[model samples]
Target: MRVRIAVPATAANLGPGFDVLALALELQNEVEAERTGEAGISVDPGPGAPPELCDPARNLVVRAYTAACAELGAPADGVHIRCVNRIPFRRGLGSSAAAALGGTLVAAALNGAPWDEHSIIDFVSGLEGHPDNAAAALLGGLVVVTPGAPAVTMDVPEELCAVVFVPDLELETALARRVVAGAFTRADAVHNAARCALFIRAIATRDWPTLRWAMEDRWHQPPRSALYPAMPELIAGALEGGACGAALSGAGPAVIALVAGAPEAVQEGFMRAASRCDLRGRSFVSRVRNFGARVDLSA
Candidate 1:
């Protein structure tokens, strides 16, 4: 049997929520897995991607399949997987989650579909060691993970635009986690909680001004900024260029600008700021992808 699955890259912990509040972006990855009698895996690389990404064992598709076979009793023998990857790695994009979810979905579908959505979420969460990106990749749109019971998700305004700035260097999530403080004061927690609530409200209502002020956080960005020395200046430039709000998009390296209506203006501002710093990299002008992961069994 053959199955094809697609998952969108996520921008998680939007601002201050830390382990919650993930949003799906327009960037995506697609995986196709077919079951054969052999006991190996192969990946067909996407265009312009490095030659090494095509290796099955090193690929996330193989990791997902191996993990699923170990945990779900699915047959990993003779699985040929191919990936069409569009998301950039280590740029605060949920590239890992997208690959894991896409590969898992393909594996499960090929194995006669034993797990439900919630079960799949749990499985991927375990594989990724976190739920923020997995939840968004699985559920789509805006997902808020409660960390205890079943993860819950809500559909947010899809019309909102997100301007993402991807710097040249890679910012590893593991390294970013190390820089965060071990604990926070009760007052600080209260502050972030209040702002998180307001941020969600602003997202639901599509209120730009509310989001601009409500999304600022003291939890992770401040401590994490030492790695990216130009963060403050870049953020300030983004705001000056017309972004309503900007923040470290899940760990760092890439900063997402929340713009109300003018994406071009935001991009120009970000470009101008980068120019001033003599930095060069790729930037994405995209909007929220309300629809998360979708599979077509009929195909």
Candidate 2:
């Protein structure tokens, strides 16, 4: 038996929503898994996938799959999985979350295990040590992950899209998070809280103009700026190029801008700004996907 699943890329924190909010993107990573006769685990990192992803024991997809198999009371070994990775790893695009979700979904499909979506989110969150990214990947669209409650999810309008700038660099989440001082100032807390609420409201009401200020953050982005000194310029360019709002995507090194339409301007904005900073990078536009993880095929 074989199973194939697809999981969407996610952008977390959307500015002040730190660790509480995220949204899914159209970008996806796919996984194919099947039981093998051999008594061992095997992983194939598909074309363009880095060697880092090919490690059977360490690859996130395989680990997640193995965990799910154990949960189903099935053998964890004797399984082969091939990962076709589109989301860039370690770029704060939730590639790890996607991998885990896809793998788990494939496992459940292969084993015919009864599973629920919420539980999947909970499971993946446990693996990733955070809820925002996996929650968005599980529920899709814009989500507010609340404890002891279902995530508040909203569907994005067809017109709104995201412009992403990815530098030829990787920012470790641990390193980026380490820069933040453990304590928060009352003023900063108040500031981020208000902006976080306003951002949700702006998206809910489709009040695009207010997003210019709504996406402001003081919690993670400010402290993270030290790592990506060019962040300010990239955001400035996106805004000047007509984006409603722009901010660091997840931890650092990459930036995401929300725009109403005609993403070309924002795309160029990212490129031009990166050039000015001498930051070698690429830019692309992606839709805010409403659908989350799904089984694409099984046999």
Candidate 3:
């Protein structure tokens, strides 16, 4: 049996929500797995691909495959895996989550795909160390995750769209997290909670005006601004260009913009902001993908 699964890239910790809300984009990482004579993995090669990303042994796909194989306790054939990745690494996009979800889906499918959606979610969440990005990758669109013994996800509206300005250089998530302080004051916590609630409401209602005020976050962004000097400028530029709200997509470098009207125009505005900053990269004007990971057997 041949299993091909595609998982969308996700942007987690949108604005003030911290690890709560995540948006899954249309850009994807595709994986195809097939049974071979022995238990091993194969990955396609490329000129510009990082050596770390190319190694199947240490790759997320192989890790997920090994995990699923261990769970099943069944061994018969080797696994041949092919990965086609478009999303850049360490740029605040959920490339790791996509790779993990894609691998797990293929593993389960190889075993007759017995595990249901919830189990898959739990599995991927465990592997990724969080549910926000994994949940969105597994079940796309806007997802709110409360991580614990068992994770829960609520599907958000598909009509909503996002604009992200991805910078050229990579900003490590660990490095970004390290810059943040360990604790926040009571007042700061309250402010973040209130804004996060308002952001959720804005998404639920699609109220563009409310979102402008709601998406502001003082918890992460304030301290995190030191990491990316261009962030403040991007936020100001986005608002100036008519974006309803803008925030750090995940950690840094990529600015997530909430737009009310035309996506193309909004994207162009973000592009202008990038140009102003002397930043060189692409801007993705994307809608929330309602359909998460799916297997195309034809592949």
Candidate 4:
């Protein structure tokens, strides 16, 4: 038996909604898990798959697949997994969430367990140690997640595009979190609360201009800027080029800008910022994906 799962890329903590919000992008990573009815495990790593994911013990996909097998009473022997990676790893783009969720879904399909959205989200979120990315990767569109609760998702406008500039820098999420650990003030909290609300409302109402201010954040950005020092310039250039709003994509070395109009303007703005900051990066323009993970099954 073989199963295939495709999970979308996600940008979490969009601006002010730190750890609470995310949206799915069209980019994806595909995983195929097969039960070969043998006694050992094999891994086929596809193009651009990071070295860390090649190991069975350390691989999130393998680990999650095995975990699900144990939980759902499925046979784990003779399993073969192949990865088709596209989302950049450790770039604050939810690559790990996609892997975890992909593996679990593949395992469930092979096991003949019923598809359960909440269980899948919970399992992947446990592996992720956070909900925003997993929820977005699973549900698509824009997702708001509260700790210890189910995530709520909203549809994003089809016309809206996001231009993401991923720099040469790689900031590990743990290190980035450490940079801002326990660093929230009452004013900072209040500031983010208002901005987060505004950002969500603006997207829902199609208020393009309001996003310029609505996406601002005083909480994680200030401290994380020390890590991704090029962040401010990148965002500034994107806005100057024509983006309605811009911000750090997550605990990012990648910056995401919302563009309601000319993508060429936004791309040029991103290039100018990269040049000015002396930072090297590439930009990706993708529409928000309203649907999340997809699965295919075969004999």
Candidate 5:
């Protein structure tokens, strides 16, 4: 039997909603798995996959597949996996989320296990140490995830497009998170709460003016911004170039601008900002994907 899984890339935080909000992108990673007569696992890495990811024993997909099998009380079996990766790794694009989902789905399909969406989310969240990216990758659309609760998904406006700027410098999530303060004052907490509420409503109602205010964050972005000095300029340029709102894509380095109409100005804004900072990077124009992870099985 064979199974094919497709998972979308995700952008988490969305400014004020730090660690609680995420949106799935049209960019995807595809994985194909087949059961083998032998009793070992093999993985073929896709283009741009890091050298470390090529090892089956240490790979995230292999670990996830093993975990899923254990969860289902199924014996570990031989499997061959081929990954066709497009999402940039470690750029806060939920590449890990895609890897985990792909492996979990492959295991479930092979075992004929009854794994529901929530179950999958719970399992992946445990492995990922956070739910934002995993929830967005699994459920798609715009997702709000809180611990001890099921992820809530809402439809993003079809007109909205994401203009992403990926910088050459890679920022690890651990390093990005290390710079943040352990706590926040009540005033700052209240401020973020208000903005998160506004952000949700603005997206739901397509209120561009309100969205501009909603994306203003005082918590994570400010502290993390120190690591990416070029980010502030990029965001300012995006807004100046007609984006409804813009924010750090995940941790640092990458920035995403939400736009309603043409993304030409937004794309240019990213390039111009990079030039001003004397940094080199690439830009992507992507749409919001309403569907999340999906799998197909064949005999």
Candidate 6:
């Protein structure tokens, strides 16, 4: 049996909603897995995929596949895997989430085990240590994840586009996360709470002006700015370039601007900011993807 899976890229923690909100982007990574009737795993890494990822023991996809099979009490046998990775790893774009979802779905298909959205969410979130990115990759659109609660997904505004500026330098999530403070003051907590509430309403009502303020945060971004010195200027440039809102995407070296106008304008704004900050980066213009991971079976 052969299984193919596609998972959308995700941008998590849109400003004040740290670890609670994420959106699926049109960028994607795909995986193809075939049962080999053997007892080991092999991989063919696609374009832009790192050479080290070809080793099954070191690969997230192969690891996820093995874990899923164990959970299902299914035979863990030979599987040949191929990856077509468009999302850059460790760029705050949920590449790991996609790989985990792709591999788990492939394993479930091969084992003929029934799977559902929540089950996938539970499994992947357990592996990822957070639900925001995993929920967005599995369910799509704008996802709000809270601990001990089912995630809620909302449609992204049709006019809104994401202008993502990805730096050439990579910031691993572990390193980025280590810089964040473990505790917040009451004022900081309240500030983020109010903004997170406003952010949801602003997106729902399509209130661009409100969204601009709602996306501001005192919780994560400020503390993290020390690590990505160019973030403040990049965010300011996006707003100056007519974006409704902008923020550091996830634990980012990559930033995303939410714009209702031409994405190119925002892209250019990011370039200008990069120039001013003496930073080098690439930009992508993308729309929200309303659908999540999917699987297909072929002989």
lDDT of 4: 0.89
Tens-digit lDDT track of model 1 for 189-279: 8888998999888887888788777778887887788877766667777888888888888876788888877888878888888888787
CA deviation > 4 Å runs, candidate 6: none
Give the per-residue lDDT of model 5 (tens digit) for 1-299: 99999999999998888889999999999999998888888889888888988898778888899899999998666888889999888887888888998888888989999878888899998888778898999899999998888899998988988999888888888888777666457887898899999999998898876777899888888888788888899999888888999999888678989999779998898888889999998989999999898889999
lDDT of each: 0.80, 0.87, 0.78, 0.89, 0.88, 0.89
lDDT of 6 by residue, 33-151 (tens): 99888877888878887888878888999889889999999876788999999998898999988998888888888988887788888898888888899999989999999888789
* RMSD for each of the candidates: 1.8, 1.4, 2.3, 1.2, 1.2, 1.1
In lDDT terms, how accurate is model 2? 0.87
- Between candidates 1 and 6, which one is better according to lDDT? 6
Q: How do the predictions measure up, each by TM-score?
A: 0.94, 0.96, 0.91, 0.97, 0.97, 0.97
lDDT of 4 by residue, 72-178 (tens): 88777798999999998889898889888988898888888886777788878888788888899989999999877778889999889999998877899988988
Give the 10-residue window scoring lowest on summed lDDT in candidate 4. Answer: 45-54
Worst 10 residues of 3 by lDDT: 147-156
Which residue pairs does candidate 3 place in steric collision? 38-78, 39-78
TM-score (C-alpha, index-matched) for candidate 1 = 0.94
Off by over 4 Å in 5: 181-183
Question: How many clashes show up per model?
Answer: 2, 0, 2, 0, 0, 1
- Candidate 2 wrongly placed segments (more than 4 Å): 181-183
Instruction: State candidate 2's TM-score.
Output: 0.96
